[model samples]
Target chain A: MSAPTEIAIHHVDAGRMGFFTDTTVCIGCKACEVACKQWNDLPADGSQFTRGGSYDHTGELSAATWRHVRFVEIAENGGHLPQLPAGNEVDVDAAVAAMENWVFMSDVCKHCTNAGCLDACPTGALIRTEFDTVVLQPDVCNGCGYCVPACPFGVVDRDPRDGRAAKCTLCYDRLQDGLEPACAKACPTDSIQFGPYEELVRTAERRVSELRRRGIEGAYLYGAGDATGEQLAGGLGAFFLLTEPPERYGLPARAESPVQENVVPATAAAVAAGVLAAAGATAAFALARGRR
Target chain B: MSERDATPALGTRGEPASWARAGADVALQRTRWGDAAWSFLFGRDTGYAAAEAQPGEVAEANRRMRSGPLPDPVEGPFVKAPVWTWEVPLYFWFGGVAAGSSFVGLACDAAGDGRSAAVARKVALAAVLPCPPLLIVDLGRPARFLNMLRIFKPRSPMNTGAWALVAFSALGAGAVAADVAGRPRMARAAGAANAAIGGYLGSYTGILLAATAVPVWARSRLFLGPIFVSTATASGAAACRLALVAAGVPAGHPTRTALGNLETGAMLCELGLAQLNQRRLGRAARPLHEGRAGRLFRAAEWMVGAGLALRLVRRPLGPRVHHLASTLYLAGGLAFRYAWIEAGKASARDDEAVALMGRGAVTRGDALRRPGEARRLASAARRPRHNGRVGAAYAETVRRVSLVVERALRP
Candidate 1:
């Protein structure tokens, strides 16, 4: 007996996992934020609250905070806001009047196909899950921090407290339990959706087309069809459907794999270092013999 | 339970109250996350029942913390993996062994001491032994060791290295085998083979580094080759004396001093080469003098200096001092390898090294242009159209070289 090329659609494991984020529908309620924290049992972003920034403060994605809701207050009248302006040093009323759009996005680890952190990790602490998602094993991490700088998107981070690596698991536990991620479940406006990977892709595609029809031409899916594109076929496991170019959300336009450029120079340097050391020792011995 | 289910959850069952308190405290810490509904629902202790768990919970936590996360995350972009870190160290090991063995061989040959020759052979074999381990360590998948032989690309220094290493190993083994065989003719042939192979291997390691994208290694290729060659010569001498000692050869031998002088000369050259290379490269040399690499480099320099001092007082120290000197030289050589690895990595990591090397390269190119301009001016009288023209006109005249040459010769 051979495996069936065409199986009944119902019999297939078509429950591909994915994520749906509706930035427009998001009210910055942060209910998903609290749910993620409670479920994951993560620590606070920091000891102090950052006041200078706009509505949402958690700053950036780090070991502590997995989900970050960025609050960008769009002003009109070609003016700036009193505290958080869309532009720097402009009139508030004018900016508010001139404001064409107000935007908010919740950022998370992309689970990139070509994860730099995974590639740079010396201890094999980083790996890919069956779901094709990037996952980290903290226990094996040597805290070398090579993965920290290797990341193109700056997603993975080291916890200063434990000196071990930490990041979102895409709720691996919840995922294993046959439930949606806590954040997605807790989202009030269905802003976060989790399901089969394929379904999510189709849904995202349809959503983009619908948005474009509605004159939201800026709507775009980041890391959806591959953010770095075919240049790096290493597709992202945790991709995003964005309403703007990825750069606006701090995503790299073109991230090159470091492994491609590093092998040669690194090998050569190692050889030189080794040879010089041997020669130095040999020379020292010769000097000693000369005295005798 | 299946083997997977038999394994407990990553977070071990602990004192529920403490766990709950820990969660509660965390909640109190964050105002936005810790509202009344969350506080009411989870409570101060939540449902954590840590007290029921066994003492093994601690160990379990440690284990889970280590292995549970399985794979780490990809955070940023544009950072290359640390292939260099492992690669540089292996290079150090190979180069060190090669140079050390060669030094012993050179000294033994110069002394014409049979015991010294035997010692040199042993040292060479010993030096080569660490190479496989170093190479394996640098590879991500050590099990696929045979892949190193999959290609014979000339552009790849590593490919060339495999061959160099093979020749060196064979020659070294032959030399040692002949010495052990106690045959005069065989010993002489082995000695010659060792000398020729050792010289090529010693210098080629430097060229290997220089041929890469590594700015520091590439810029100092010429000097690096010579330095390693000379260092090998000194190490070979040291190994020769050490061998004689092991064989209990008589002390106060004149040949010992000659080997010592040879070593001293090599040390002086190494020191001069290091200084010159650094001066020429400037900021690119920072790695050689800083951090772990810097410490190792300084230690090597100190060892070489002290070894030189020992040479000056060998008469006072007597024959026993040769052993100590050989040991120092050996230690210093390893230190240099470690330092060089660390320094090269640093040079590659830091922007300054690349900038300095690039500037040096550009300057060298600029310098070459001046000589060409001067030559053009000297030959201007023969080509009137090209006379005094430097950039475009000089090129055009060169392009019409046959006509100009014929016109000048016709007169």
Candidate 2:
């Protein structure tokens, strides 16, 4: 029989911050990936970029990418890609063997409180649950691409395979049953943790302190703790713990939403269009009359 | 502006009756400022004393998140929950039909083309047929779409639009029927009717969106009307070109050329207005010029530009080119609508946009404090706050006006 893998899982409300990823502790095994997919019933995206430089082929989060373990491999001495440690040859095998510094972080959708995707959805496809997590209703989506740009994080996307909008539902159905999300369930390292939003924030803070005490002072939560409304995109529903800055993982430094400003110009253009159209119609009539 | 125009005579014996005149007259007459003080208490749509606040009003609920602890539901910024979905169909149907019908009447009137007039009348009636479907299909409860007619509220664009649509539909139908009966005299009257109803049909859509609390639509209310007019004209011209070809008129018919000229001019107007829109909108406008919708709008605009150039050069590209150009212009207009809707929703989704609008409201409140303006805002503000449902329903009314403007101005 297989040994039971213990990973921490918690339930949280929508607004409280959570997550502090300690990349230094990660082994890049992608146990989190298997757990999320196996539990979520997510179809496997075939690995093509796998086996290259300690990297996992799962590059991002999608409806399928509920959890993706990113692998960033450094030289034995910790340097750039395509270059070998001073003692080793540059072949793929040697590179993998010589690689001593590898940072693995599992990423997922940040259930944002000020979710622009949910706000922009004309058909109410995107909704926030009582848990404060943002989820998508596939049936209600009209496939209007408004949410694509409205999302500051570029998390929500249209399934080109299907026309409807798609994003992680944060395992909403499971949470309702008083269970943790699938991704957290399968994490072998206790790295991808889940819990109440407030408790998670506190846990993440304590975890950061613990790591800092252990001499890994660089550990920090990305969208979690101090990521306020001004600094983040409406505050992430699922905040992250990270050792490096958010931008290193492709998050924007600051976010802005344009919905309010657009009404003024849109209204003005509409008004001008109305007046000009009337004038033009009148002119057309005059010209026709002149010809007569 | 011309002496000969004489304010374009609201109703002439030779002209068809317009519903807009009734609406405009109602609006002008119901100006509470000029009427007795009691009028404010009983001011039709503007009057809130009789109506109960919607159920959602007791709880400050935005379908989207509301920041900084929900305010007292009874406090200012109280909104009636949006009763209807902001249906995309309404945008298309109302604007398309209005533009198509208005063009038919106007073109036939201009050319003295008897067959064209008959076709125009038929098309005009057909245009009005879509309004009910548009309104009903987009409603949360399609059955309630008809309740809009109960009160003739001047401040409520939806009420005005409902009355206008009904009036326009009757006149449009009568005009067509007269033409079908070979009543040239009545046909002339229908043309006049079309003229009167048609003028405001296109402009009302702009007014509708402008009156909303939706910051994107409210801020640019002034220009949206003109843009709608321009696009509608371009579309009307395109529709006319199609009708002409269907009628077996040769590609180079004088009427076709004239329609082409109108379309070209309108396309130019739309482009110029969009440029102006870019300047006024700041970052929100980025979605209009970038990404898929932007690409489509730009391509359509380019096609119109090329078509305009071809028409100007007088190369006589034959029916195919003209037809292609006409379709291109129509496509461009639709793209513009798509872009506008996308941009508006995008703007609404942002917390910052709300904050910015919130701050702008503060400054606006400050500005209103001067002289008599503050009193009006305060009074206007005193009008019962709507829940999100009511706001949505109200938005539909404004959308109706926007739709009309889009149709009326089609080329």
Candidate 3:
């Protein structure tokens, strides 16, 4: 009874499960990050040194770092601080006067409605779980990195430690045990919620409205619905509620469902090119025949 | 212990030392972040006080450190996703050449040029024979390669491509065998089917790249297929030309000229389409024209031009000139595939390219406060150079030249 653009041939048994990460409430505790690794048995990306950037110590999502908490500090004085002027020239006094605004978001896989990784897999390695979340079968993945580039959000990655494609599995094992995901369970603020996809969307919508009512400008649900607002990647299975545009959170403004947008045109272009080449050869043969 | 007890707390069961170390490390991290954040707050990297009118924009230094579209604070560059390496592009090159050979063989057979057709068939077989092994190499094991067939996902281009490669290789080999065995009718039918299969084999590679979400490849989706087809046809004709002349088709012979002319025309098409693809992509095409990949692509273009010049303008009527042209064309074709594939990889690493998806061109309108701030904030990144008026003039000149070449040497 569900409509997805990728595969209609197969029938799935279970209801779709997803996450609704509300960035507004994230407290930058790194609990979800710690929880995801503990559950997934992933390693720390590396020893944390002075990154000297934002509050972000662990740089990004990778095979080792399954979950990432992004800390975007938007200063009211644009992004300038008084001590540090543009480039190497520093104005220490001016930097101190710069205004800072913090937006914390715990990032994870979208588990897209039309997954590019699954569609691009040549070896049938990436598969949708019974819970309707995309999961990787390690035994089948042959280290081919097609899925890495295929992801619109750039989530799935090849583990440099082990040459296999890997990403968040939406805690498929825990789902089997009738439990919620690790990240959601660890969220102290309940910013990251886990439940049935439909129920979460309803709750998320009300939460956005409540936030807007409280004078939170641009507090909207991304991938909510095609009719309401942005329905990127045919609507992210793991959607978000953001105060800023998607780009600020490193999410694509219009996450493409490549299976439909990129693939269809590619197929049509290939067919047309093939026909042109064939016709060119035929005309040559016809000319040769005429001479004979 | 039950499953509840068996599962680690918070999904992890790190050693107590590591946990303690993690906690201590976070404290250390906090100290460092605190210092940096303080420095940042004081206009450390902020350019001007007036520019700070907006709320979210960061100082130029912070943007420089981590400049991608995503909110990721630490990951500096763009997506460093490299799923396909040398094997995939090499596979595409070989597969396209094989398909092109089939086209040549079919045309020869239709025209009663049995000797050339036989050579073409052998060339087709030789070109395609390595495809299966190459694919196996990419997949890491033979069983993994075979696993692609387990599902007939017409919805997935990668699956369809796997099947198409197998079909083309099998039919090409069969046609070659039939011709060798003196089974005229069998060879003719197989060769005909091989020709049909070749069309898919020649052009499917472009679709494979285009269908992906990589900004550079995806943006040029409309033209890459045609570009690949043109390259395939030229390379196939060049291969046949080399084989035929080696077997003693004289330099001045109509067949040599005809094949050379076809190669020239197809290379011209490939060149124009590549430019068209680049122009259409705007800033997203920077990776295709900028680094090692860019160097290789420009080299390929020059080689194509060089091949055409050698055949058309060079003096001395010898098979050597034609042979050199064939060699240049072949080299150019290989370079095209390799460079295109490499460029696709590099393009994925571009955070700006990723951010520019759906909304191409990092313009002033993106953020009114800065009014073309991305350029000032990101001078470290290589800028894509465009020459629209001159490019149009050049395109027109190319069209006129191609027409002249085609008319002067029609098959």
True contacts kept of each: 0.02, 0.09, 0.30
Give the best candidate by DockQ: 3
For B1-411, candidate 2 gives per-residue lDDT tens digits of 011222222333212112222222333232311222222212132111223323332111111122232211111111111122345524553455466447656655666766666665676666567766766555432333444453344443445666777787888878777877879788778666765566556556655544443345545656766767777677766776687689888755556666676787888987887787667754345456666546766776777677676666556555577677777777777766665665554444433333334333322332242222211111112232233566556545643553344335435
Model 2 chain B: ten consecutive residues of lowest lDDT: B73-82
User: Which regions of candidate 1 deviate over 4 angstroms?
Assistant: A1-292, B1-95, B103-115, B352-411
lDDT of 3 at A132: 64
Ranking by DockQ: 3, 2, 1
For B238-295, candidate 3 gives per-residue lDDT tens digits of 8988888778876665555556767777888898888766766667778887998999
Better of 2 and 3 by lDDT: 3
TM-score of every candidate relative to the true structure: 0.45, 0.53, 0.77
Residue range A1-292, candidate 3, lDDT tens digits = 1443233223454577788888877878899999998877676665342223444667777766678887666523355212322344545554334323667788888887667777777766677665667877655565666677777777888864355677898987666555678898788777787777877666666665555455765666666534312345556778877777566666665655455556766777878887788678656656645654
Predictions in order: lDDT: 0.52, 0.52, 0.67
Top lDDT prediction, candidate number: 3
The deviation in Å at residue B188 for candidate 1 is 2.9
Supply DockQ values for each candidate: 0.04, 0.04, 0.17
